[model samples]
Target: MKKINPHTGILVALAVIACWFASLFFLLNWHFNWSNPLVYLMVFVQMHLYTGLFITAHDAMHGTISPNKKANNFIGYLVVFLYAGFFYNRLYAKHHQHHHHVHTEKDPDFAPHGFWKWYFSFMLNYVTIIQLVIMAIAYNLLKIWVDEKNLLLFWVLPSLLSTFQLFYFGTYLPHKGEHDNEYHSTTLQKNHFIAFITCYFFGYHLEHHQKPGMPWWQLYKVKE
Candidate 1:
């Protein structure tokens, strides 16, 4: 069995959720100041938080968030919904398919096309009309109280950018090229800080595929 701090997943989940909401609240209330460097910084900050939200949900899908199935799934459902109106059950099934079929045609995440084509195909797997409708509804409702600019820049834009951040570091790079390894996955050079900053250690893609039970925070320990 893989050694792990069972408490870490839930704790990290709570931290990511709390930070996402807090940053969103602050940004929604904030006056826009392009002249201010903090305005720019906060975009990246919120983008990272958005990625963190998905990472939390991903961990939950693996049942790493808690030993209790209900708690684990609850956290998964919560974070994915918070991320972008994603359905936990839908993602759960698709993700398992991803693992089982991997890079094969049956894999929901597999796209043999170039980056842009692959990205759109990847987005299609999870992005639904329902999600778009939910986002539209939420935007209209929230804009009544919040500035539209702040909502777009801080909320919508960051979330969109985070998709690129996630797809590039986590999916595109790791699985783009052929690999001789059993998992058919590529990992980054062993730089723990780079791994974490890139995608919460998801850059260690081969290690993750090998030990799907391991949580994101613990990937570095196993990188060796």
Candidate 2:
């Protein structure tokens, strides 16, 4: 399982990224009815691919993407950059602080106030000069080959949606409010399908805190 998980992880990460941009390519080129609602529906589906990309990076932060540290970090950086501008080391540090100091001021993800506040805080903390430069380069390079609308809807907008998805399901909903448990995490949605759809079973967040070393795919299986 250990060996297969890393191999599988990289493949899955690449697959999600391909799904997002490839679908966007097709969607942008295809002439569709102006009022077609399914267009938005499909865009939201592509947003799931964005969510998957970030989730893969999150797994890499936990060092579960591969047994080989270098390979894991490589894949993590690729998928995260593909998602949008983000510094892996910065995210890693903040996430570790979150786990170690959950619900406290020191917890980078402290969300006692509510969901929106936490989401913005999380997003703001991930940005840095290096990340901005990387994003700018990516934007210029992608614009050379991709349509502006496609880039916004598929690459940029979806990445934005993915942030709310990650924070709402992965952090705020899980760790909000007063909880007496050691981890202070919650299982807001126990339905397996909902958990899977929302954020790759991250809705079972207490299980995550209970088993930090476990991969996101296996979080739901934990007896939280």
Candidate 3:
């Protein structure tokens, strides 16, 4: 695999971080009309931005976000913290374990059962008590100033929904069935638009596992 310019990854990561916060701020302050379709549209839009946060952090974990280790890890920590108060070092360790172990029992990202079962196992490995406490504290504090409904609909729900979007596209589909390939993962049919919307081009799962150093934005290049 060809090495991507490290600055490209840095720019994308920063852009994603900016977008996530901007969208969250806008939605949290927006006046709502549940009857309007646009209100619903904003929900999914925010959801995708949430997924982008994780993808940016995921790239940082791979050292794709910056050549400097400290810079890369800082971005990773910031995004995960913003996303859901997740611990970056815990995620970083587990993610590398997933890569090394692939679809085996040792892989924290994998499970042998169906979608729900696998999702539970996956969440158990990543979600922590500290994360819950942080989120709970943030929610209560933010709601004192922000609209509770907006926080629930835009901030809270979107983050939860984004988890399913990511798990379905990035984990369950790719690693569910038996794979004969070396990566033990599968790819979606080549459609970059669908790929991006689905999980930031992570539906190209084999390409990702094959070239672990590639950033989310450049995964389509690996496909080509």
Candidate 4:
């Protein structure tokens, strides 16, 4: 409910951007023999790391990682364009705000309950390698058909949009109390852990949900 402070958000956003770009530069420049399996493995690892960084950026966008509105918007835009490749202005805000307010439920943004339900649901809900590949192919094919000047939209735009949706469903939805049947259990904790491992522990969901105003590093300071 409190207004986000811009100064803290800018600082955090800059740091996150620096880390993301640095990792990307390293991965792109690394000498990799496409013919070698190890090189392919390295590529896969780098991709996963990039995904994690992207997730961190998502937290920043929600202002859950920092209190800077400008910084949150800027970082959100950067993440969407540079990493995920979409440009959602109002929709991102609406979806994210609803997530914070509702946690999880029949909310279009959250996931429904069940163990296997959560697993398969989350996997399908999030932006995975398969989704990225399919998007890329679809974009190229669409460009060929549409003859559009901006070919990036076909893949990049959808990737960004889908990534944002995934962030909402995969992270926010599962942790919603309603979706969890009003019982916070180990499964929910594991969900947070999975998000942490996937996202470099960018402020666990429990911490963020409890204290949305805290910066990313300090989120863990909050106790349930």
Candidate 5:
């Protein structure tokens, strides 16, 4: 129901797509030669780009990318399918709402605590590259055993799941103050830098919390 800036969203979407295609070119070319360390390096770079693309897609879901709900939903789902492999819109919305409301608390969406300790608990409260690799392997193995189809289940599905998990956990956990309230500490500020790099500058959580209606490009200027 709320309006957003269409031009900003289109530009971001275009930028993400262009970067993704460029990265894909290098990744595909390098995929042919596993013996070369450069291939592995390119793979790592591509994976990060893949994650960043998903983050941009998240911007769409938040309606920060456009005023058109239909366009936002379509772009959001496409990113989910391409990056995360699932279509859990209801789940994403519900969890993200809680993430904005609770953020960094015990019940926060990104909390790595509780029974799911391995996935949730961490000092940095961010997913490690090693964890991602392990999850990728596990997801592929399960998909092969369950679906008997190797393609989507192996590569695409796991990537989607990981992206969703990252969105849920990364944004929800590590937030220290109540929503709409002033940020509580310097630690949060420092963490934002790390998040910025990992999430393509979506890590400016305090600014975002203050101005949920603003586009990502304009959120950096929000005062705490």
Candidate 6:
């Protein structure tokens, strides 16, 4: 698979991070009426930014973001770690495991039980020690400069919300149940809009498993 132009891809990734930083700054500086609904809406928008950061890292994991392996891993590490903190190597390993084993018992994304338990299992494996350390450092650093309410509402809270969004739309919905196929995954919505809006085409689990080399933007063209 041909990777995206390294310059373009890196620029786009940097633009997103810049936008997120700007949004956080604006939210921190501007005091809003607590009872207003727009503030909450803005938070969800920020949540999607977090999810986009994850998806960006995910592309790098598949080696689709850059032709150069070093650049790919570097971009993946930066974006993913910036998304509420994570060790990029751990994420790469676990995600590769899901693609290899998929719906089987060996799959890290799978839990044989109900949604709550499965989600718990998914999250347990996702968290890493480096993430905790980064979070602590970020909290301490931000305490000196940013308001606690702004930090929680604009940064920490969106990250937590994005976990559910990614887990539900990306993992649980598409690969939750039993499957007979080789990959043991399913295509979710035929609606391209929903697919992108949900999890950046991650809902197309079977397509992704079949053509793991393809980037997120191209997955919508995949056919059953």
1-224 in candidate 5: lDDT tens per residue? 34444676878876876776676544433324446576545544555567766766667767766677887778777765556444537435654665455534543344534434534453224344654575577566755544433234334443545454455434534353344455421113544455554555456665565555665555544533
Stretches of candidate 2 above 4 Å error? 1-6
Ranking by TM-score: 3, 1, 6, 2, 5, 4
Q: Let me know the TM-score candidate 6 reaches against the reference structure.
A: 0.92
RMSD of each: 1.2, 2.5, 1.1, 7.8, 7.7, 2.1
lDDT of 1 at 57: 89
**What TM-score does structure 2 among the candidates reach?**
0.88
Candidate 4 yields a Cα-based lDDT of 0.50
Write candidate 1's Cα lDDT for 83-200 as tens digits: 9998999999999898998899998888999999999999999999999999899889998999989999999999999999999999999998789987779999999988888899
Worst 10 residues of 3 by lDDT: 1-10
Residue 76 in model 3: lDDT: 94
lDDT against true structure, model 6:
0.84
Q: Which ranges of candidate 5 are over 4 A from the true structure?
A: 1-5, 29-32, 103-169, 176-195
- Cα error, residue 185 of model 4, in Å, equals 8.0
lDDT of 4 by residue, 1-224 (tens): 35545565566656766765675455444554447676545444444444544655656655654455665666776765566444546446655654545534533344556544555554453345754675576667756645343233222343344343445544544354543432231123434455444444432555555444565544444432
The C-alpha lDDT values of all candidates are: 0.91, 0.78, 0.92, 0.50, 0.53, 0.84
Better of 4 and 5 by TM-score: 5
Compute the lDDT of residue 133 as modeled in candidate 2.
Answer: 90
Clashing pairs in 2: none
Off by over 4 Å in 3: 1-3
Angstrom error of the Cα, residue 198, model 4: value is 3.8
Q: What residue pairs are clashing in model 3? A: none
Instruction: Using TM-score as the measure, name the better of candidate 5 and candidate 6.
Output: 6
TM-score of each: 0.97, 0.88, 0.97, 0.55, 0.61, 0.92
